[model samples]
Target: MKSKGKVYLVGAGPGDPGLITVKGRECIETADVVIYDYLASPALLKYAAPTAELIYVGKKGGDHTLPQDGINALIVEKAGGGRIVTRLKGGDPFIFGRGGEEAEVLAAAGIPFEIVPGVTSAIAAPAYAGIPLTHRDFTSTLAFITGHEDPTKADTGIHWASLAKGIGTLVFFMGVKNLPHITRNLMDNGMAPDTPVGLVRWGTTTRQESVFGTLENIVERVRAAGLKAPSIIVVGKVVTLRDTLKWFENRPLLGKRIVVTRAREQASDLVKRLTDMGADCLECPTIRVAPPEDWRPLDAAIENLAAYDWIVFTSVNGVKFFFRRLFETGHDVRALHRLQTACIGPVTAETLMGFGLKTDILPENYRAESVVDAFRGQSVAGRRILLPRAKEARPVLPVELTRMGATVDEVTTYQTVQVRDNAEMLVGELADGAIDMITFTSSSTVQNFKALLPEGEPLERLLNGVTVASIGPITSDTARELGFTVDVTAESYTIPGLCDAILAHYQRL
Candidate 1:
């Protein structure tokens, strides 16, 4: 007999990636193979190691991508081979995720297994929409039921009438198709016709949408609103609280589409923060940074470093790349014994400090204007200032320093080129209306977006209805120049501020 492996049936939590439990993340990280369902958020896959094999065993109503028997066999086969297997499911695996059936199969095969619980949509859906399952003033109990069942069975075995009268709150999953039947049953079973009910679709995600109406008219209202499946149906007075406690949708940048022009490597944090506030982020890299085309200029700059009075780093990228070159040439920050270092922002200053170099000057505000202002009124006659930055970088620093009577030697430490093909796949997404918004963090992103967009009136028509979000005045000007209206701009020049601006716009509507 082969040595059996351990299997973990892990819950991925309701739609929100942050809601995923720590233990579930641990299991996914260590698992050799992860079999996941379609409903699970793709973000959760990031927790798995790159070497781990991922298998999709998602099933829809009557359509099975991988049959239950096949999935069961796969799990058992992998476990029997002594590989650590993780069965990742959306929400609580045990709660209608068919985790019990898989557990039984694992047990019958004598495979060791453990279950990691998650925040089930049964509770999280309502929570994200501010609908509590139970309220002390309204009700003390809650019931979770499925809206889908086998029609061939003798009966669902649920006492609808008893539940309608006895339960304070009733939450149903997969109930969109049977909304009419469920509403009628509840009404006939002594539930009030005017009882509040809400259908939350794509809960806890930026795409989340909520429809509210009484039991008497919810079916009609949802139909009129074109609400789709993968929704949670809540029947209770708690549904009324959404109007007052709607904090998620109140973020500054909620529902606005902003385009981030930063490189892929640097855009994750900014994009995540913007998306969390309900803003749809579009990533269009206006500038692609690459190593300098020739090392002569960089080598010469390093060798004559002591002749310069000041070394100004315009970006964190320049700081990083320059230091890497310095190390390659077998010289450290100590070699710059007489050069004063000036950084544009706290982030740049911190990066310089990481290399054991203290910044001599850092501005309170993080902009080119601020950096130039910090050195204003200081005598710069005959002083040599070294500026190592991107090839296409703005000439504000060099021009302004020259005006200040300083001899500036500008070196292209890196090249920032336009990305032409990044939007190839996104064209289909844009045409299909899957892209709800496009956010612009900088003027360059707006320019690059227009360059990448497909030609003609189709691009304009596509962007017409899509909300345009800007990070600041400069980005807004670029967006307006592209013939698109700016929908929202952050009060502060930070990603979180941009998000808050988006949310504020949506909440006002």
Candidate 2:
């Protein structure tokens, strides 16, 4: 007999990644294998260890990835192998998620298992849309029923009479397909023809769409609006609350698909900001940061750290690598007591300060030219400066310093390599007119992104309707030189500044 492992039937919450419980996230992080559904936020998978296996068994409309029986067998098989399995489903695993059925199979197989409850869309979708499921002023009784009833059953199992007349609020999931049938059944069962009804599609997501009409005309309104499946239907007077409390739909960037062109390691801050404002963010990391090919120059610089009068860090990567090697070779921050540090921007300076080092100079603008201008007014004659930066970076700073009577030793601390993952999906998004904007944080990002597109696909026509955003003038110039129209440029060349610029651009329209 094989030693059995534990299975956690974890609920992934309705849609928002933040809505996930702390316990649920921990299970995913420690699990050997995670079986997640389509309704589960992709962001939640980020918590899983890189070594974990991810299986998607999402069923939307009639398109089923894995049937229920297959999923049950897979869970039992995985657990029987003595591997911890986290079966992540959307909403509470108990609430219409068929979690009970899978749990039964696990029990029959004698597999150790536990259930972690999650926020179901039946409650969260309406709440995010600002419709309370239960209010004292309205009715306190609430009923949650599946919109998709089994056709093979002798009759519809739902008590239509009780739901129509007795229940104060009726919430149905996957009911868009049977909207007419649901409405007719309710009205015929003594429910008022004028009952207020609202359907929220893609609820609790950035792409959420809500349509409001009475039971008499909701079907027509839903048809005209072209709302599809994966929606929640709400009945009773609570439907009227949407008119006064419609908050999520009013978000500035809601429904806009924004592409993030930055390193995957560095895209989280920008991604969170945009997603918080209701934008669908796609992380297409253009450049991957890694150790330089030759560490001799940087290694030598670290050994002779006291010889240099000033150390100039052009990027956060530079500061990170410099100190990492400094400590690795048996050096510490105390070795820099006699040295002064200069940085290109506040962000770079902030990164430097993180090491308990003081910044002697920070240029007014976040550009190499600004760094040069700052040095132009200072005393640089007969000074030795050490610069550690990207291998492919421009030589503007070092070249200008050499001409200013300063001996400069520039070494590559890190290099940015291009990443081509999901380029096909990116091209498809553009072709389908799904992307509304693309943001570039650096010149390297801009160049690498262009290289990812299919060869000979006219950039002009391929990105005709999409807006191009730049972090600053340097990136904007690179974008323009590459024949992309720069639609928005940040005043402050930072991720937060870029977010503000993007929001302001949409507001102007």
Number of the predicted model whose TM-score against the real structure is largest:
2
Please give, for residues 166-259, the per-residue lDDT of candidate 1 as tens digits: 9999999898988998898899899999999999988887777889999999999999999988899999988888888777766665545555
Candidate 2, position 172, lDDT: 95
lDDT of each: 0.83, 0.92
Error of 1 at 34 (Å): 2.9
TM-score of 2: 0.98
Q: Please give the range of 10 consecutive residues that has the lowest summed lDDT in model 1.
A: 250-259
Q: What are the per-model numbers of colliding residue pairs?
A: 21, 0
Instruction: Please write out the lDDT profile of model 2 over residues 18-42, one tens digit for every residue.
Output: 9999999999999999999989999
Once superposed on the true structure, which residue ranges of model 2 sit more than 4 Å away at CA? 150-154
Let me know the TM-score candidate 1 reaches against the reference structure. 0.85
TM-score of each: 0.85, 0.98
